[model samples]
Target chain A: MKRFATKLLTAVLLAMFLFVGTQGFAQTINIALANNPISQALNKLAKEKYKAAGVTVNIAVLPENDLRQKLTTEASTGGTSYDMFFIGPYEAASWAKNGWLENLEPYFKAMPAAKLTAYDRPDLIQGMVGSLAVKGQSYALPFYGESSFIMYNKELFAAKGLTMPAEPTWDQIYDLAKKINDPAKGIVGMTMRGAPGWGMSGAPFVTIVNAFGGKFYDMKWNATVDTPEQRAAWAMYKKVLRDAGQPDILSYTYNECIALMQSGKAGIYYDATSIAPALEGAGSKVQGKVGYAMAPHQKMMTNTSWLWNWAMGINPKSSDAKKKATFDFMVWATSKEYAKMSVDLDPTGSSTPPAARTSTYALPAYSKTPYAAMTVKALKAMDFTKPTIDPVPYVGLQYIAIPEFADAGTQMTQFLADYVVDKITLDEAIKKTNDVFNQVAVDGGYRK
Target chain B: MKKKNDWPFILPAIFVVAVMTQVPFLLTVVYSTLRWNLARPDMPIVFSGIDNYLFFLKIPDFTVVPEFYSIVLQTIIVTVVALVICTVIGFLFSILLDHPIPGVNIARTLIMGPFFVMSTVTGVIWKTTILNTTFGWYGVLAKSIGLAPVDLLSYYPLPVIIFLFCWQWIPFFVLIILAGLQGISGELVDSMRIDGLNWWQSTFRVKLPLIMNHIRVAVMLGLVFIVKEFGLILVTTAGGPGTRSYTLPYQVYMQIFSASNVGRAGALATMTVVLTLLAVNFVSKSMKKNNL
Candidate 1:
């Protein structure tokens, strides 16, 4: 028994020694990122450079919903499983307020003078910076920023004898869609995301609701989804999709819209402006045949577009050493050097991250791209602080700015989808959704 | 007497099982009694008694039923419908394939292909390649016939999902039932034929009784698995068209991951387990009664 006890003690001590020895040799950080085109490119571009920095990176690329769930679980549990993660404005602001994210402002101030100069913290887009900040404390670094816009096939418009206005109204766009729709030729007049999720159909749909002067809530947290203005927005959304949208409109997401535009099957596409590069670059059948326009409006004219970004944030639960290593990697990944590397790596210029930095737009190569100016213009034209014409309890252009909004808003989209598909009456959809949302608000102690 | 000393050998497994299942379950029951919303970091997590359970149980209006009941009903309907179709069609297919024919093994293997495919893959194939109104074969075929194809995934999501579940699971039923059919003695078959028993009588009266045990086992396994299916629903309908096809497990997932209400999720999970156990017990009892 004494021999066995000694042997077990020695084995445990040896295991501890090996663990400490390996951890001391080099720092390793785990980063959770959403699986998107730009992040895929980043994963490929940062391979050798991350290893060369004397730190190993373990990245988990998951679908957008899965990424959000995993990162939220880790942070809420105060687990140190992830050292860094990719987050959007919704998560950045909420997590920072929860005291879950490492304040990157202090990290920025602590950088060596010369290194800070090279990092050019000021050159990062202020709009993105402000969105990811809470009470003037920065929570994340913008990797890429985007706003919404309209991308139309100029050839289709010309053939139909219709010219798109630079800033069109929703009514005008609907009329044009009616004119341009040609199902016989397998062409639809417009394409938008219709998949049921908060980020899927809800993004574009919320902006439409904003343009139509509808708010999800009143100043005192009363649900206003069944209001006249909101009903009008829903009617318009349903009318266009039913008349001129894809045959499988309910199944279409942004990827499908992109593919439809590239195939020249869509007359108009309204989605993220960042996808313009993909529509105009090599391998696109509609290259040079697409035209850009601002997001459409009906009542509220200004700030009709959305502001969105996927930023990098540090986990507050990480040890100081891992946090430092993670901050360094975040710096490198968002640096000008990485931007140039990405641009050079992608010949088509479609997959390179963009709109995060002022200097990126100043690059001679990027400015020459036809859609770069429009992308920047759209990004600056929206404000998330004031989303609707009427006073509301939330702040977000394309989403509601509460942690509970992701759940409630997604539940609301199911009713919208059913309404869009004529599965339920408009009144029934409205009553069910409002009930669900109001119940969530009351349960979460958000409403009085 | 040396056998009494064997506890040391069994204690590790008991410990592992306790840690893996019972401990977590106990924690879940404790959590279900609290008011914990992970999303609302501002709210204090405190003991709230049975408030979480009551939240799901309370229905404000009979006309407007709560989602929990609807989800449970949908789960039952989907499981029961899918099992019936799979068993009926699978038994017929097994009877046909049980005949002596060349390349019978090939046919059986081909039928088993979908059962081997991942559920997510099956959903993707059905959604994108078959049911998609614009990009799929259904669209082309419908258009060729001069008729517009309605979006089956959105309009008739429940039926489409039930059909796909049957397509994928029927093969598993066939495998087991066919084994039972092949096990019947050749003397019995010769005796049935000599007694002028028709094919229908032999099949429905004799063969089915012999295979009730196999069918019961298949239904039990199917119920256990299909009730917990998440990926297929996610990849295809996503529990949408106003949660018309949502199951209890899907609701638990939404409560935990989407709502970030750990307490509520625990409540939903406990109810789901209870409902599942009740279903399994009822099935086992009914099957035993039928056997008797």
Candidate 2:
């Protein structure tokens, strides 16, 4: 009995020592990334680098919804499901405010030379880096940034004798959609994301609302859903979706719209500019025939372009070692050298995510690509300093920077979807959506 | 020895059930009473005394009364519709495949295929492959057949979702009822046939009543499963069409995850648990009455 007890104790101590030793010697970083082409490439690149450094990176590649759910679950629970994660500006700001993420400012400050080389540079597009701040805190680092744009089939335009302007308006896009639509040939005039998610649909909706001079909240953070500008925007958006867009558009997300465009089924696609590379890839039937332009406008281009990207955010709950390792990988992965390496590795150019660094655009290799000028122009035009026309008590390029925004935006998307499906008339949908916004405001103590 | 044998038959199952369900359920109830944000620095759980509940209730746009009621009503409508449709279709198909048909096995396999598909994948397939307005095969076929494109999701959302749910669920009903059909004593069926009643009469009077227990189990289980369904609603419509199809579980998700109001979310969850219990009691009571 004494011998058995002694043996058991020895085994337990051995196991504990093994765990600590392994944890100390080899830093294992868990990265939760969204399942996009860019993310896939990033994962592949990350594994190679981390493995070479004797670090094991457990990559949880999940669909966008699943990734968000898992990340949110882990974040909310204060669990260490991941050491590093991919987040966007909206999530970074709102989540950082909630203390859901580790502020990277301190780490960046600690490694000034590396940070300067990677993030702070004239060569790195100032807009991209500038967009990563929330309440004057650098919460995340941009891996890639994008503004929404209109990608049209130049062949279809030529065939239909339709002319696309240099900077097209919503009205012009509508007309073009009508002219080029040929359902008989399985071609639709346009495809836009109408799916019910803040990221999927709300991005475009914000742009539309902005173009119509519809501020979600007035300068005082008062509800503006019932405003005529918003109503007009909703009505116009509904009309365009009904007439020129694909059927069951409310089901379409970024990937679905991209598929529609790549398959030559869509004459126009209004979505994130990051899709330009995918659309220009060899697998795309419309590869060489696609043209890109800025997102359509109705009034002024207030927030016509949405600034969105997959970004690295450090987990607040991570151990110091884990945090350091995550920051190391993030800095390296987002570095100019990494971007060049990615481009070199990606012979197809589709795998390399468009990095936010201006040096990436300046690279002779990137400049010579099919999407070079248009993508860079769109990325450069991603102005985070001014997203909404009217001043509001928030900071987000394409989203309202509040914790309640996700819920409110989702509900708002559902209302917009209702308009698309013709379940409710434009007037009714607007009223209902306004009611939702007002209710949210009241509950949030933003209004009486 | 007999008493010793009794626990062996039940102990493992009880243990499994306790671990898998009862504990988590208790945890959820506890979680319902507190303000818990997963990502806080300290992970401090605050007791809000139903403040979250009141807050969720007071959100003018998403107040509990109209929205929750609408969601509940929609769920009931869809569940009932799916139940009737799946039962009828399943019954008919079961009868069709009972004996020998050239492609009966293949048809059976195909029917079961949708059941095996993950809910998210099924939603994706239905949304993109069939109901997609632009490149969906249905749209392509509609155009090919000289019909103007049908916006299935836009024009027919609830029915489309209900149809997809029913379509997926029918195979279970068919398979279970088929098992019940096969289990019936041949002598009893033969004796019934000897009485000179036609096939329909035999089925309606004897066979169906004999399988009433099976139907009760299948339909009630179906209802429970259907009512608790979150993935389909989450993936497909997300309880939209202006919350026309919003169900209880989807509402809970929207409240907690979307709204970030843990208190309100807990209240909604507690209410749903109460409602579900009430429903289960009503179903079981009605089932008992029918059995008696």
Candidate 3:
């Protein structure tokens, strides 16, 4: 009986090893991504497409901040738990500089020339490419990109006899908000993100600062938060949100803004062009009733819009086999064919990824979409390399490009929130923001 | 009875406690002294003693203190105020529920429901269904009554957070204190009644003394958990209108993720641990004195 039991145990152990060995030989890649609508659609598409090719795709969809934290920890430590990271322009440039990302240039060059030509790298929006590149090497592939724009309720505008301009200045926007604001009708004039975070209020607010010709630092990296242009930008944000924004303005973020606009309670919304999908398609109460305009500017007309992308990057420490699989998946996901294919999922082209490929805008399914033309125009017009009208050292339009910007920008966000809510005086806010920025500069050893 | 060789049996537990708790804490202390930053690869991570702590602690001028001090003050105010309310109101609820009233079991279960809820859900539910000005119950009720609904969260952030914290935590205080009240002998209650004590005197002077240990246990547990409350704050006010609602743990988070400064985060974390220990120690001592 003892001998029979021993033999049975041996057979079970052999079966387990066989199962484990088969798993090891199978192709699989793990991707960490932002939980956005585009990515959600991509997640479904890739699971089916990759599974057919005998490659397993495992994806973790995380909120923006949580994704950043997870990726930062994994990349910084050279961990290999994930092969691909869905990061933004801010992370791409900084992580590339840190040598945590796999440089995709060599891989692109090694691709079959026919495949490379089919990829048509130049057809990508130059701003999106620029944001994801360090020096000359591309670090990530843009799945989707957005330049900030103004989306307004056409029904509300027509009702109030307010015609939105082809191009609106900051002052004009404020005036429009005031003219269209109807508290009795339960419709507010504007919706802008007021919740505090570098990515929340900081993204749009920085562009407003740039439009007013305010630089966070000079060429020599001094804290420039107290300049005249800076003050004007500050006052504009405060006055606009306080006078015409939602009742719970201080607690508002882009998510809240999207909900308000989707509910048809907001007159105008100033945020990412990416929000066009949620407004124009799939459970929207205001479909086809929304109008698009360029991002409102002040002193700097050409670069008022902020450029952002949720793109995929390969971790350098990932196995070569895993990297290859990850890149293949990324290419197929971002290809023009994917845009055409997304129509099966959503006929409105709302779930279709936007602004990555120039060809995507020309697709018959996408061309008729309301936001396509304005999106391309805005994408072409934005120059993140020359963010502020005045020359500065940084390369980001909505954010400062230095690694310390996240921390520094977050500090400014708090001060801005306080200033907007009448919690602190303008002078006090300026002094405090300027002081914190200076301290970050000194601590980061950037000023030296 | 002869003592057995218990060291052999207890050694594994001691090893686990040292590895899981003590070693990580020591590592944090060591990391606090290093000048490590995850973002800037050009700058080499090296040992830079005291600089990280000084970053938060140093005040070049008295007129303008660093944000660390303000965040610390905010954390203390929120935690202390919430704990006090939980103790007072929780005791009152316990007294009311202690009587032989019909359907009291249902009332006890309903009161305990909030304590079992996750903090993030509590924040989201309250923000959307209750507090929102345009759509929430508060707004609809206020408007129907012909009054303008203020954004209570924005206008009064600290007070709102305090109230939410108490709403969730007061039941926990009752869970422990009510057990203490039940443990009091029935003969003791009869004697107190026979001594001609009024309701206030009986409940406060007699029953309160009996439950002092339970109150201490509840307060200590509440302080430890409430001091590190982050999720609710993140969902509710997001440590804003400005950083008026930021706490020690929030600063630690900002340092680690936003600043990507492991050393500074470690320093802030160590300081937080020390401050929490000081608070717990103070509460323990006072509660012990009360017991005596």
Candidate 4:
């Protein structure tokens, strides 16, 4: 019995080795996606399509921060764990310069059909792709682009006899919020993200600062946030968020704001345009009584609505064969036909690709949706020319450029959080943010 | 002749230990001293020496201190608080369960349910369901009681996290101490009773003395758990409300992943390791003295 058992174990080991060897030759694409509704739909579509193509696609859906952490770790370590990743323009330029991403210029050129040729790349509304590309090589493909807008409760506005314009000023928005705010009835005048992080609080703050004509960095990479424009913007934002926002606004992210607006607690939600579809869904309590308008501005009409959300990128560490497979999969998955298939499967219209393709937006399917016309108008009306009212060198709409921006930005964010929590003064926070980053710049061999 | 085969006995163990601990530890030490940004791995990893360490120390956010000192303070706070709370609660419950009661085992097992939960899940459940200021169940209850809802996160983050840590770990210590309690020969209690010793006196002089070693072991284990706790902090506060609850592991995470300051992050990790070693040594020395 012992001899037979030993023989059986040997046979099993040999068979496993052979199976692994065969499987090694088989092409498998490892795709990492953000844990968003649209990405979930895309994963479901990729599984079916990749299976038909005699390839296996392993998908890992992670939250925004985890996805960033994992992808950054993998890319930096030159690990080939992910063949394709859903990234954003935030790290695209820096990652591309670091040679962590495969330049998709050649691939896109080879497959002209996959490229947005006749779709007018310049008029795509969000010109983040231009910012993401270095010299002439496109590093990451744009899956979706977004800008901020004001989503308000129409019924509450009507009840309060408030009149909000198609494009209102900051003062008007503040007055409207003050009028509609009824805390006794469990309604807040306004709700925006006040969570202390670059992505959470800083994104909207940057836009407001831009509208008020703030500049983060000067011509020579010196810290320039102590300007009058920035101080005014920061002061105003703190006042509004503190008063009209939920008591727990300090912890609010995009999802929290969405919940606030959808549940009839918020009179106005200033956030991403992508939330319009979600807000207009059948499950939403305040669906039909919602209105969309441009992001409120101050002295200038310019407000930077960033091209945010996940985009596909190829891994630089992958083998040539793996790269080809990844590129092919990206093209196939992001193709117009595939998007249509995704929409068909998930008819909520949440699965449709948020692209700049005029042709795709002009589709009868997209046009039939209530959000289609407004979404198109919002996309078309976005101004990339003047991202900031004040002069600055970088092109990022919602963030500062430079590799050290993450660290410096986080330090600044913590300072702001402290100030808001009354741990420090706003003037003290400003001085600290500017001085710390300026010293860091000097230390990193840059003139400040 | 028998000693010649000792190499064979130790080879596999050595290999496993190296793979699991030594290699990664060595890498962390190397990365901590070098200007190695993972996003730009191709760039020649420059040797910045103690500059990264100094820079992290001087990081002008809230406080100015060496990364080593900051991590040591945080590690002590988390471990010490968790150790005291877990030991007190665990010992109390273990005595309760030592008696003959109907459904006692069921009650004990239900209390241990938190030990079965993933740390991340624990953080998420607490943050969203129980501790959420506005819409959470806890908030709803608070509002129903005609009280202004409390943002448990804003004012009381560290204490709530400590409570969570204690809630999860107390059951494990209970299980350990219960086993120790059961092994304390009944004859000792009988002898105490014959001597006319009260329950409190017997527990203090007899039962407690016997379980000192077990208690030490539980404290040591709890120390290790608290030292490595990052998931809860990361998920719940992300080390927030202005860095009040930032622990050693969470600091390392913020430095490495969040700030992408890998060199400084490495310095933080090295400091953490040194502190963990010192803590373990201290615990073991105390345990040896107690045993003596």
Candidate 5:
């Protein structure tokens, strides 16, 4: 009996070893991404497309903040858990400078002509490409690009006998909001991000400040947060939000604003154009009732729309084989063919994810979508070279490009929130914000 | 000779403790002394002894904001308030559970449920479902009754966080105090009543004194946990409405991740450790003096 048991155990151990060895031969690439509709579609397509090529794709979709924390920790330690990571333009330059991202220029240059031409390098949006570049070298590929815009309920406008122009000023928006606001009917005049984060409320607020002729800094890196333009912008924003916005404006983020618009509770929603599909998709209460317009401007010196993109970058610490697999997957994921496939898979006009490729925008199926023309126009109208009316050191529309800008912007957002909620006066908020920005610039050696 | 033989049995635990506790702490101290800013990699790291510490401690003459001092005060207030509330409420619940009543076992389990729920979930449920101005029960109920819905978290972020911490920790105190109550001899309670003491007097004079040690242990544990609270603030308010709810841990997190200043973060972390150690020491010394 002992001999028989020993033989059986040996057979089981050998079987397990063979099973594990066979599993190792199949290539698998892991991706870390934020939880969003575009990522969800890409994860599904990656599995279906890569399975036949003897490759497996695994995706870990996490909340926005959680994904940021995970990626930051991984980059700091040079961990190899994720071969590819989704990064926003705000962190791309910093990540590249820190040697956390693999430069993709070499891979793009080495690609075969057939694949290169098929990919159509010139078709990618210029601003999107520029945002993902470091020192003229591309470090990431744009999966989808977006800029902010205003989505208003046409039915509400008609009912209230209000007319919304194709290009409205900030004053016009405020006037419309006041006219249409009806708390007793559960209709909010406007929905905007008020959550306290650099990327949340700060993004829209910066755009507003720019339209008000305010610049974050002068060429000498002297903080201009205390300028008259900025103070006027803050005052206007607070008045509009207090008199026309929903209650608890301080707690409302993009998600809350989206919910408010989709449920027909909001008359105007100013946020990323990426929310267009979700708002117009099936089962939405306000589907087919929404009208689009450019982001509101004040002085018309600079457009108020903010440019942002969700892009993918290869991990610098990943093994060569994993990097190759990751690049291959990324190329296919962001290609025009994949964009068509995404639309085909869903077939709903609403499933068409915003494409970065010019060719994809020209597709008949995509153009027929409700907000496609407006989105493409906004994308073209984005001016990254001159994000503000006055000359400044930063290149971003919604944020300053330097890494220290995150902390500075977050601090300013807090003071802005205090001003909005009546916790502090406008002068106090402006002084505190200027102090924080000046301190950051000095500490970073950006100013004498 | 026996002691020499016992070294093998104790060496593994000592090694684990050193690796788990001492090594990281030593690394934090070392890192705190360097000029390490991840954002400015062009600048090389150098020895910068005590500069990071002074950066946090220094008060600017131009402004009276007292940023660091405010965070420290907020941390102390939250910890003390949460400790007092949890201990008092927990003691009351423990007395009620000590009696032999029908369905008491299930009732105890129900009361202890919040302790088992994760802190992140607690923050989310409270922020989104309970306290949110729109789509939340508070909002819906307020609107239904013709009243303006109040955003509790926006107006009272720190107090709401304190309530959440107390809610989560009261169960812990209840469980520990209940165990202490069970260990006490029932004859003492009967003897107190036989001496013409009322129920309330008996609880204060006898049961309270008997369970004072358990309460102290609970308070000490609560203080340690409260001082390290990050997820509750991170998920709910994110130390916001202009840093009104910024705690020490959240401040350290902002320094490292948001600011990308590793040296400053390390300095803040070391300070936090020292503060926690001092608090623990004070509490333990007081407990010894009281002989509870």
Candidate 6:
């Protein structure tokens, strides 16, 4: 009986130790992310670096639309499946307004001064910080900030005897594209997103509209989609895409455009500045031959480039402990320390996160990199406070920061796509685009 | 006048069915009567009394791309075209498979292959591998032949979607019609042949008449399934080149998930249920009249 009792006690003790050890060793936090290069890089670092720091990070990377839908569904029900998620500026305000995002200001304040200084809150890009905040309260921390710009092949320009200005106009870009286009040689001169969704065509197209002096809505919220500026922008976009764009451009999104540029097939790619890392990465064919320029201008009353940031927002429904863990991971992942560590891991600066912080950008190694320098210049030039030439009742450049705008923007993209392919006439496309905007305006109570 | 105690045995099944099917439907009906926007929590939910329904049904100006009526018409047209193509092709394939040709088993497997593929995979394969303008097989073939590759999805979005649906579901119809063909005895076919009927006459007058019930079943099943075809359309073209291919189900999905207008989505769902019920009822009545 004594021996049996001792054996039982030993078994119970072992079980308790195992349970406590597991609990202490592996506290997991789930992160929902969009499947972008930045997110993938973060996931790699989390596994390699943060796993040893006592928290197991589980990341679910989904496509952009799928991630949006999943986060929206979870937010609607106040679900706790995800402890944190990546959100765009367009969704930050709406999600914050809906009480789905945790206010990150308090968390930042609660951190020790030493830690705060290390994180360097003020070092963050002002435009990015402003865009990720709602009513002056930060709700998310930007993982990487991006603005639109034109990336071209310097070698291609030299071969074709073409001169691209540092700040080229849309007409100039179009002419360059036509000159360099060699369909017989299987090279596309220009590549842009033509996929049907709003995030695909609508993103770049909105910047075009802004550069042409088109407004989504007037101060009174009347849809201005039928304006002469919008028509001109659409006409230019359609003609250029048809004449110089890659074949089956309708299926091309950002990834496809990047692939075309990297494979030395495209002469010029006008897209997000964040693609710099991929374009200059080790595997890139045009790494040494790529050139950066400002986004093309038309009227140039306002900058044509858009302001976008992929930021991490904590779920409001998470427990305080989970929130703390999430914030810790977020700060660490976005900190200068993390950026330095990333650069050390890959000395070529390809793995370095887009410098959200001024200090990170000031790093001697990062500042000297061509892509990094160009990206910082573009980021500094963006004015999120006034993204368009005309005053509109929204705060977004690529997208209007309203929930209704998601639907309206997607519908308008469909119309623009059809118009580009000659599936519908320009007039019909404009009418349909205006109708969608008007309906959204009235239904959202922005107009009567 | 008999009081059957079978209720006791079936009560659990009835309860399960009610819980599985009726509760969400009832919730949807309740939700349809309220004004609920998930994005606008400041706007309190209140009784709106068919406002959402009316809003959805309201006709836009003809200039608009997706007038509500146009979506409905397009949905119907796609469903009909898909059904006709699936039924005819499936029946012919079923007849072909019944023959004792060499390598017939392998051919049968190949014919049944698409049915096992998921809808999303079907859409992706068609969009990326088959129909893509640049890198797809169609483009490669077109280019190799020294012709400009056609952007089939952009130019003919609806027809291409219909083709995808038909491709995926035809195998299902084939299996059904093939099973129905097996039920007709060899003796009956022999008698029809001995009765001086030509091959075409026997097929039209005897075999087709016999399998009319199977054809009806296939059509009804296709109608029921095609109305909920969201994945294929969502993955390819996204109901576009301008709402030329937008269906009612895709519209409802956009209203709920994309637009966050749950009340409007609910209203659309209620209408879809009603229409589907009416269609099922009509199909059943026709089957009864034919004594199948």
Task: Give the candidate number with the greatest DockQ.
Answer: 3
Error of 4 at B149 (Å): 1.4
Leading candidate by lDDT: 3
**Cα lDDT listed for each candidate:** 0.87, 0.76, 0.88, 0.76, 0.85, 0.84
Ranking of all candidate structures by their TM-score, best first: 5, 3, 6, 1, 4, 2
3 or 5: which has the higher TM-score? 5
Model 2 chain B poorest ten-residue lDDT run: B56-65
How would you encode candidate 6's per-residue C-alpha lDDT over A1-448 as one tens digit per residue?
9999999999999999999988875557899887777777788888888843557788888878778877887887788999997888888888888888999989988999999987888888777888778789999998888898999998989998887898888989899999989998888889999886667788899889888888888988888888899999999888788999988877787878888898998999989888877888778899878899999889854467988888999998988778888999999888989888877776656777684777777777777777877787788787776767777887777888788777788888888888988878999888878877887787777775
Model 1 vs truth, CA RMSD? 4.5
- lDDT tens per residue, model 1, A348-437: 567677888888777666777778878878887888888888778788899988898888888878888989988788888888877877
TM-score of candidate 3 against the unseen true structure: 0.94
Highest TM-score model number: 5
Off by over 4 Å in 5: A1-9, A47-54, B1-12, B286-292
lDDT order of candidates, best first? 3, 1, 5, 6, 2, 4
The candidate, 1 or 4, that scores higher on TM-score is 1
lDDT value, candidate 5, whole model: 0.85
Regions of candidate 2 where Cα sits further than 4 Å from its true position: A1-28, A47-50, A105-123, A134-137, A301-303, A379-382, B1-65, B94-112, B290-292
List model 5 lDDT by residue over A323-358, tens digit each. Answer: 988999889888888888877776544545585777
Extract clashing residue pairs from model 6.
none
What is the C-alpha RMSD, rounded to one decimal, of candidate 2? 5.3
Tens digits of per-residue lDDT for model 2 on B1-292? 3565566778889999999988877776776778764433344677867666665455455433456666777877887798889888888777776766688788878878878988888987887777665657887787777887776666676898898898789888988888788788889978987898898998888888888777777887888888887788777776766688778788888776666556667678887887888877887798788772
Give model 4's docking category.
acceptable
Kindly report the TM-score of the first chain in candidate 6: 0.93
Predicted complexes: DockQ each: 0.63, 0.43, 0.65, 0.44, 0.64, 0.60
Clashing pairs in 3: none
lDDT tens per residue, model 2, A21-125: 877888788998887777787888876764436467788788676677678767776889799868887677667777878888788678868557645445555
lDDT string for model 3 (A1-448, tens) is 9999999999999999999998888788889778677788888887765443557888878766567777888888788989998888998978998899999998998899998888888988777887798888999999999989999999999998899998999999999998888777778999998887788899999999999999888877789999999999999998888888898987787777888999998998999999898899878899999999999988987779998998989999988888888898888888777887886668788888888888887878788888888888888788778888888877888998777887788779889999988888899899999988887788778887
Docking class of 3: medium
